[model samples]
Target: MDLSVTVDDGVALLEMRRPPANHFDEVLIGGIVDAALGLDDDPRCRVIVLASEGRHFCAGADFGGGDFAADHVDAAARLYRRAVRLFEVRTPIVAAVQGTAVGGGLGLACAADFRVAEAGTRFVANFARLGFHQGFGLSVTLPELVGRQKATDMMLTARRVGGEEAYRIGLADRLAEPGRVRETARALALEIAASAPLAVRSMRATLRGDLAGRVRAALDHELAEQRVHWATRDAAEGIAASLARRSPVFTGE
Candidate 1:
């Protein structure tokens, strides 16, 4: 649950450093919200870079590592607020995704202004596979990046998209060499960093929040959907089947 922050050349770089997969739980999610809060208030930080330090970019909530399921309801509430902050941030944001961004991690990426990843990196909405549907604002964010058809396919089928295809499909802005993801992300941030801060901030805000009311409504719908799914037998079956390496025998339960 280690989060690091650095500011240079009018850009703030925030790194997720939980090792291995950088899986985020309640505390990590709160830390993210706090970072965004700080960036919004910092005059020197014109652009913010969200990067992770690990082999895989993120694996979503750390349910197995802690009491996430016990606090799942409150966690989702906090994350919903965090998602709003991320999209409403007055500064442009860049994301460096070096590997898999599954479930909520993928949702977080969709909130970024620019997403750069390695050619081999994988992006998957995997909520269905987990028997859960807590994607925060991905219902709108993902469709905005790709399209309704592709977003539906990704979310419903729970398939993975490679970094190159993600870029071509508009889910990612650039694909870098596996070892150069950080460098490429830094370069892109520097380009934004050199721009007029006020103009850049305004443009990013407009793009991310063109329909603020609609976005919030969509978020509320998603949260409600998530609550219903999480309390269902089907979701438990999905999690059990995944953990046991067996196909889920869903009976519409």
Candidate 2:
């Protein structure tokens, strides 16, 4: 399993164990969904602090070899189903973003109710750079966090937004000192845990009305578009260029 869960002082800590970039796949995302759903029913867990034992929070899918799907199922659809489960869980989440949250990783961070990041933390929405439509429910989560204009800019330009700018743009809810991202996130989780659990759940549900359903709907379109793009020569070129650390030349293919 790529995930572990522990509870302390009404705060549940869900840690992703994949190191380096911490790219996510079906198994990893399913583990998170299962754990979060269990925690939602555990009386001891009032909030969840989502962190990772890695240089980066998550670098999204490892296209080189990462398994985004099972052999029997459609890849992106399966992964997006698990991704939707994150939005359905009742417990609020706080993500500790250390180094970078790129591609679908940015969507994962946005899944959290709050995010704690440091000045140097980089958040990139690089789907266009990769020559694909964004997945992991980013179509809904990104615009919700950073507004439609900023989200459109990020997706189209594929720019890397640092923590300070992220906070300024409402992408990051809080900023911590360097090397203290997880600790600060845990502290914020603890603070939320101090609130009345029932009331908090009620308010959260009210504020997030129809969000999970919207994400589910958005994912269907995202997956369909990605499927079309994946067959394009430009997508092949973009991916090759990215892996080779060079610029891509798209010819409207």
Candidate 1 at residue 122, lDDT?
Answer: 92
Q: Please, what is the whole-model Cα lDDT of each candidate in the order they appear?
A: 0.80, 0.90
**Which lDDT tens digits does candidate 1 get at residues 1-253?**
4999999888898989987778887677678768977888988888888998878778777655465556666777666765665665666778899878988789778778889987888999877877777576888888888999999999989999998899899999988987888889889989988988888867766665564566677788887887888788888888778667787766667
What is the alpha-carbon lDDT for the whole of candidate 2? 0.90
- Model 2 Cα lDDT, one tens digit per residue, 82-178: 8899999999999999999999899899999999999999999998988888888899999989899999999999999999999999999889999
**Runs in model 2 with CA error above 4 Å?**
68-73
* Alpha-carbon lDDT of model 1: 0.80
TM-score of each: 0.92, 0.96
